[model samples]
Target chain A: MPVTNRQIRLARRPVGPVRQEDWTLTEEPVTGPADGWFLGRTRYLSLDPAMRGWLDDRPSYLPPVGLGEVMRAGSILEVVESAHPDFRVGEFVSGSFGVQEYALSDGRGTRRIDPAAAPLPTHLGALGTPGMTAYFGLLEVGALNEGETVAVSGAAGAVGSLVGQIAKLKGCRVIGIAGGPAKCAWLTEELGFDAAVDYQTEDVRKALRTHAPDGIDVYFDNVGGTVLDAALTRLAVHARVVICGAISQYNNEHTVQGPANYLSLLVRRARMQGFVVFDYVTRYPEAAREIAGWIADGRLSTREHLVKGGVDAFPETFQMLFRGANTGKLILDLT
Target chain B: MPVTNRQIRLARRPVGPVRQEDWTLTEEPVTGPADGWFLGRTRYLSLDPAMRGWLDDRPSYLPPVGLGEVMRAGSILEVVESAHPDFRVGEFVSGSFGVQEYALSDGRGTRRIDPAAAPLPTHLGALGTPGMTAYFGLLEVGALNEGETVAVSGAAGAVGSLVGQIAKLKGCRVIGIAGGPAKCAWLTEELGFDAAVDYQTEDVRKALRTHAPDGIDVYFDNVGGTVLDAALTRLAVHARVVICGAISQYNNEHTVQGPANYLSLLVRRARMQGFVVFDYVTRYPEAAREIAGWIADGRLSTREHLVKGGVDAFPETFQMLFRGANTGKLILDLT
Candidate 1:
């Protein structure tokens, strides 16, 4: 175990987009695990769009990260010392271990992860929160069916990429909307998405018409803005819109521009629903096992944009999430 | 049969709140029904919030009313002359007969109504489109469960009133939000709604906090806008918000301000779904039977704001719906 621990703490709440000055890195002497507790060092830190919402002091699925506290994040941790009966030394586990070198846990919400199953960072990426989010948000909340057209915004990002892949696995036509040509090409070429619309280049509304000629049956929305509004107008009867995340609106200091075409829900007799992956805790093992099978069978692709640095890299890396700077899962390697 | 048929036709689409000048009254010579068609005289017309949406030249569940075309409406009609096999003289039927003294139907989308079962206006009110909207909207779209809390906006209006009543009958605690003290009182005292919030007089958010301490499980929203936003904030985990109508935004020539607190769907893992009652046509008889049973058992009450006038009064009476000047179902009786 390290003699000292480095931690990133929230210094202030962000306005509009997050900045480096909002976080503070500090060092403290490491302490041994107490009774019913385990000490683990964070290996891979997971950065997500939802992290922005957690920075604001508001009521969400999870509580906001308080100022002067270790910035909250999901990470892969290796148990260094253990006083808890269920956790032991050298075991890899994942949980909300925060953006720090070491985490002290009573094993309340941590789940053991196997390095042999996939890479350590893969657990923070495809096999971790992003993977689980894609799994449940598409299958459970979206209720996707075979041969249906599934369109997703932020198509090259962590949740959106995996959502398209899984929808394809379920025998559905997948269309992705991304910011640039390179990301759009990556989605259609490498990830096997049926088609990709580069929002930065093409008119999304017109592209959606050309691609999804039969209208979208299920839309996995990760970025909410005008893209969502365009998709709204093209919904088939009984379309199920999974409100996974709205990265576009997360950084907005102003009010969220809710889809002006929301009445399309009435016109098309459709549903738009939101969910938190944590709500499916009991079913996680089942989903994780299936997703693992897909990965092992080479049906699912896992990618991580790894940033090599200590705790200080968190703020800059987190900014990449909202700016659409990083594709696939963005991670910070603390080791 | 009348020698001449008086009708109201759309003059031009209104930019905002409909004006009297937007409609033109005309008279046409009454003709005998052609082969396979029946002639009918209108009795009561069902004035609905959806009428405003139909007036606008936009794509919706149904097509918009075209300029110079007889204004489309649902009404109770007495078969004055019959050339169709199934039609008999004086039989009452309901269909899209438009705002005219006489209609010609081929029995395609028409359903016969028995005046002996309830008053003729009741069929246009508690047993017609409004009642059906409340039934499927609450029971199916909202997926309301016994003992859950249901909050509805436009509490004194046709659909909202019936939604609260049906929710209460299904063993749920019901809270209503409406304009004016009398309308709120009608919901709580007359309709058996557990609580009522007068949106015009009280702080709706604060009232919702006090009434639905556990949070609203099913919110049947008819009048959207700020009230919908307030309800969005007070949702419980897995709450269902049925988006039946947004009368508040129907007249806006500008953009619709969607719920600012819609992210609460993500926070509480809730759902917001919109539906058209026409989509539930296969099960209308099933719903109508149950709702009529409630009325027979004295568990339901019926109210109609009756307006007596010729076709020229159509424009002014239609305005009553948007102005909230009429309680319950607003019907123009042409008898």
Candidate 2:
């Protein structure tokens, strides 16, 4: 019997803000696994700002999603049919299976995720690529030490939420920068950030002054541009600014926004570094274990803003992340 | 008997370059030493660009050279008379003895500069502030590992010249950046620099690309702005950029030209830090010993661009440094 499922394919490349016309929904006939392949039914599709970067035809750490190809995405799936010895029927797995209802994988770079360990969506979030990005970026790259102050932009979002939490777990005084009162409340009140800066209402520089009076030691930057400029002014001696994402600049039609006032690095004797999560693929299990422990100990909490939708709703759901419409990790559940 | 002689005093504050109009030479009625004081006759005075910074009414690492103050300069003197317990008459002494014919000291912070062991100006150049700045800036801050590529701008100047020779002494592949071809040639041919880029004629970034094809491991920055930006582009993985000074930015009438492209730090996971040599004052003797030893042996050489003029010529002497007219250590010998 032929296996078939609905898939979201890239219809056209986007210019600025990605629209529904950019994506095309279609049904694809999935071939049965030949030998070491397993059939995957897409359960939860992760909506990340990095998806916008994949739409543009540029040389990034990852290749752009080609036109007429299935739009790339990280998904958690239940194995329905298995010809692979590693993956069995009824086992849950996670992989870059694209925005689809069903997928067939050769099991290379795919992990069998546990549902009982945490919610299936949490595996796509706190235990997923976002968690690893935060872990390695903060500990390895930022070299965050105990008693240091950590100030993270996009503090209410997926990766940044975890970054602030993990920094706090490392005994750092964590400050969160987000859009609205709700996100700030979620960060400081729920996620355990020491301080929260509402980028809309409060001046970031003034907020940083009020919170980190001694200046920030580690800055986990997610939303770049103006927010980055504000953060640069408040860096202490030997501070580290980690460039995780620039969601604000991703949609700009003119130019990719780079920081203007980086001379502060020279004056403050500090450093700024950028990283991609894929660089730490070999160390993911070690990172995931620590994040899981934080969650279990009530030190780190996983917040998933689940948006129920079919594969056709991928374009609109992904827009929610850009508009700051979704809090925590935005996940699309295809039932 | 009165220890009376001529002295130069700061007449007015300079707006841009320290001109001849900024100084006034007059006869000062000097007095003999009291109970704990020693009277010394000035022999050789060290003229430095740091004098220019002192003339400005700003809080730098040290206090500004004040109006009506005997224009501050480091001097080597012969003790004509002594009442201080530790210092004896006819002994050689070194201290911040202003631009004057005679100075009285309490021997609190004065050290004996050996004229028999080496030339008196060597105490100001290779064994002075420039030498100390270069030694600590490269080893402790630049973290100069063996066999690493080191790129230093202003390589013919006091600090830069010493940095290249020391990096070479430490088994590093050193590149010197200077203003003229003659200076550049001297750097590679005599000073033992691996390569030299004349910034006046050569494209700094392109030259760096050709010379340091393996990419620069450590950048000892003295001239900031464009040279720093050029070095920033050529950084290898885990590079360290040491910001010693920005001679280009110091005299800027308008906005100090900063580096436009600094995002490369993110790609390479590099670090750039600025430091003042004064902070490392306690370690000065330690650096002095190592650098003095390097000069004592054939491992290092000293160069002095000496101007034969009275104390009244101090302001014009300082202006030459900003114009890049002098090579090696710029000093004025007071007769």
Candidate 3:
């Protein structure tokens, strides 16, 4: 008997916050792998804030997911069957496998990951795109220096959590801004962040002044809007503002609220730059090796909020990011 | 008989646009220069848009003009008497003389200017702060390359006119955005700007698309607001946005309007930076010599709207900058 493959596809472009009706879950019969092709059974799907940008039909760094097409996603999968020379059966691999139970690939962007080295979901979090985004966004784009004060928004999220740790490892003072006391405590106590601001209960600008008294030298902005505005006000002279992501404004039905205090860049003689992590793909191996070393020494910690559900759970699982409900990397475990 | 110094003093901080009540015209008997001081009779007072910023009680690159104090201004003056060793009587000089008929200086931050080298008004227009702003802003901050496309707002103003002309000299395609058909025509026909967008009549974003089809490589922003938003959208990959001034937002009683499409920086892998001309004070002579060479060879042209009025006319003359009534440098000639 042929296997049944369950998949989630985009039904329509989302107006604001993604609704369940915007996606359709369907199942199809799977066939055996053809020549030069390998069949993979999806194990975990990476749910990212950036994924929200992919659903819109606007021109961006990457093309938007087409209506009625399988929702684009990054996933770690087990190669159950293969006719390809490189990929063998029963080996775990990571690639853009979409929101599906089974996928066929010729191994273009696919990379083999050792489950012994790190957990399968870890490949979708700290060792994956989130890791890459945090690494390059802080070290390269933010141009962080030792002894400098670094501030990162979305402090409890995957990218922001890693950013604070990396900045700390580089001998810098780190301040993390998150939604609540629990998430903020997790950053300062568990992740070893120098300070954490509970943006929900505290005034961000006042908190930043108290925490980073000398002003922030590097601000890795993951959440743009009023947080970005508060960060702008506290910039040290010649500070660098790295535009990693703007998760705060991603699902806006109207226009994105810009940083009204951006003129602070002028008064401070600073710079605000933006970049895509894929632009540094060729250097990913170099960064990954360094990050893995830190993790091995127990200096760097990794966390993931794993939701045990099939591909059909993508919509609800994905909404956790915007709601700030997840502590770290949010992943759907489809095992 | 002692000279009576006519002066304009700040009466109160302005809320929105500057009103007549914000200033007080007064006269005081000027005393002879003391040891290490020089006395100067103000000739031409520079009316700049940046002056608006100094009137507000906010922390900026420069301190706000204090109430009951002489209005801070840049001016051309004739040294009438000198007790300082370096400055001599009967010579012309330029310095911060304020909006007054006579000023006393300690010779610090003062530069002697030969009337034969350039006209007295030209010293304030192109060889002064405005010229320094355009040179460093376009070449250093903007990091302009040959054959690249450059777009400048306030294209007919003191700094914008020079930026467009300099880019043209560097083998780049230049587009100027200014209000009114006359200013737009002057930019293209006289200043050699490749194209001109009449922002008053045309949609700035649509006009930029038509003029800069390949997108702008360097956007020298002088007038921020919607114009900055328009320029932000039309930036090329790796474009540089030099934030020199935001004249449009200077008079706002409320908050400034930020570039709503600022995320384009990420999509295009671009950067937006701000700088103060005073930061490059040491290199001013080197840039001045190069710009003077361009002027001598007819490659650069300087224009000044000379208003022949005494120091009392300063309040009305300064308002012309906000109204966009001046074609080039607006100078109140008190000679």
Candidate 4:
């Protein structure tokens, strides 16, 4: 008897906001794994803003997902069968498993996970790429100092949330910029951020003037566009602007809106730097250990917005990230 | 006998390109030097792109040149009368002496220069602020390394020309982006630039691809507009962009056009940093000594476009920078 597999594949590249017509759901018969390979059942899929960049055919850090191929994604999966030496049946692992019910892996980037250590979704949120992004983006790239003021955009998102918390732990005053009142409140009250600015309602430049009167020492930017321009206007002398991501401009049909106040770098003698997390892959274990300790000590928290309905729900659930509907990590529960 | 001082004073702030109407020529009786002051005759005035930034009533590294005030300028002057202990009569000095035939100085920012070492205008050109800007901007801020590829915009101008020469002296492959055939020819033929892109006729991005091949290790941006955008796209891994000046956008009546392809910084893991030459004033002697030695040994060369007529010609001569009319170190020979 053969098993059936359901998968969402890229149909066409999206122009602005991704639509359902951009993807095609297909059913195929699952094949057994070959030697040095393993078969896994997808349990959860991580939907990130960076996924949007991969959909464009333009040159980037990684290649674009080809049409008719399974949409690339990070996921937590359970090993159902294996012919490989390391992976065993009934063991859970994390890797780029794509948007499918079942996947075959050669164990290239796969890592075994202890499900009892933390929630399965936690492996995708805090202890995953988002966590690593925050750790390196703030501490290493930002070079955050004690008592210095830090401002982070997309403060309620997975990476930004962790960034603010980590800044707090390092004795820095952290200010967060988010889209709504609820998210702003969560950042200030729940995450221990010093202050939160509601970018949806308030003037960001004025808010920054009020919150960080001395100007931002380190600006960890996830959202770009107008908010980025505003932050540029309030940089302190020798400030560091960490360009981790620019989710705000990811879906623009035209070109990205360049920061108009970029000349502020001259007046302020500041630096704007960009980095990719995968470049620091060799040190992931050390970063992950530190993050896990913080999580265990109750010094850090993780939030996951789980949407159920398998791989077919992927297109709709992925839109939530751009719409700011999800407060934290947006994930699809395929279990 | 009293000296009649003819001065060019700021009459109004400029909206776009500066006009004769923006300045007022006035003659005043110059009094004897005070107890700690010295009286000096202006010899040559440096016409810089940064002067345009001073005319705007906005926040910057320095205050705006106030209306009715003598226009600030870096000039080579000869002391005629002195009451100060440090400065002596007939000594040539370099300082911010304003656009005037005679200037009264307390010697706060003034430094004595030996006219026998090089030409008088060389002190206001290659051994002055422009020289210091190139030295620090490339070596320290850009962090340029040997055998690297370097691209510099406004490559025929004072700072840009020196920037390319310094990069060449460091054993780097230097490419210069300048306007017109004459400036481009001079950059490669006389200045030893490996390649010269005539931005007026050539496609800068394609030219960069042909010249650099791999990518530019350092992009020293002096003209920030379409040229800056082109350079941003060709950055190598860990590239440094030194924002020294923006001559192209300095005269715009509206907002500056930001670099549309700034996201390349992220894709290439690059950085853009801005700095002021005044910040490195304490180390100017060290940099000047190195530059002077390079000039003495024929490793580095400098060109000065000296315009005749006294202080009254400042308004028209300054316009040459915006028009890209001068090749290197535009100066008003007010001798």
Candidate with best lDDT: 3
Task: Encode model 2's per-residue lDDT on B1-335: one tens digit a residue.
Answer: 65457888999987766668888888968788999999998877887765666777754546887888888888888898888887888788887898988998888667788777668888888887788889999998898999999999999999999999999999999999999988999899889999999999999999999999999999998888788888988988788888788787666554456554454565566777767676787898899888878877878989999898776677677788888998999888774
Off by over 4 Å in 2: A1-28, A47-73, A97-104, A223-226, A245-269, A273-280, A308-326, B1-81, B89-111, B253-258
Residue range A264-335, candidate 3, lDDT tens digits: 888999999999999999998888888888988999999999999988889999999999999999999998
Q: What lDDT score is found at residue A45 in candidate 3?
A: 93
Candidate 3 residue lDDT tens string, B1-335: 38799999999999999999999999999988999998999999999999999998888999999999999999988989999999899888898989999999998898889788778899998899999999999999999999999999999999999999999999999999999999999999999999999989999999999999999999999988999999999999999999999999999999999888889999889999999899999998998899888988988999999999998899998899999999999999987
Flag regions of model 1 displaced more than 4 Å. Answer: A84-88
Worst 10 residues of 3 chain A by lDDT: A116-125
TM-score of 4: 0.99
Q: Which sequence of candidate numbers ranks them by DockQ, best first?
A: 3, 4, 1, 2
DockQ of 1: 0.76
lDDT of each: 0.91, 0.85, 0.93, 0.93
Docking band of candidate 2: acceptable
Shift in Å, residue A246, candidate 1:
0.9
Model 2 lDDT per residue over A275-309, tens place = 66787798898998888988888878988999998
Give the CA lDDT, 0 to 100, for residue A261 in model 4.
Answer: 81
As for lDDT, the candidate ahead, 2 or 4, is 4
Clashing pairs in 3: none
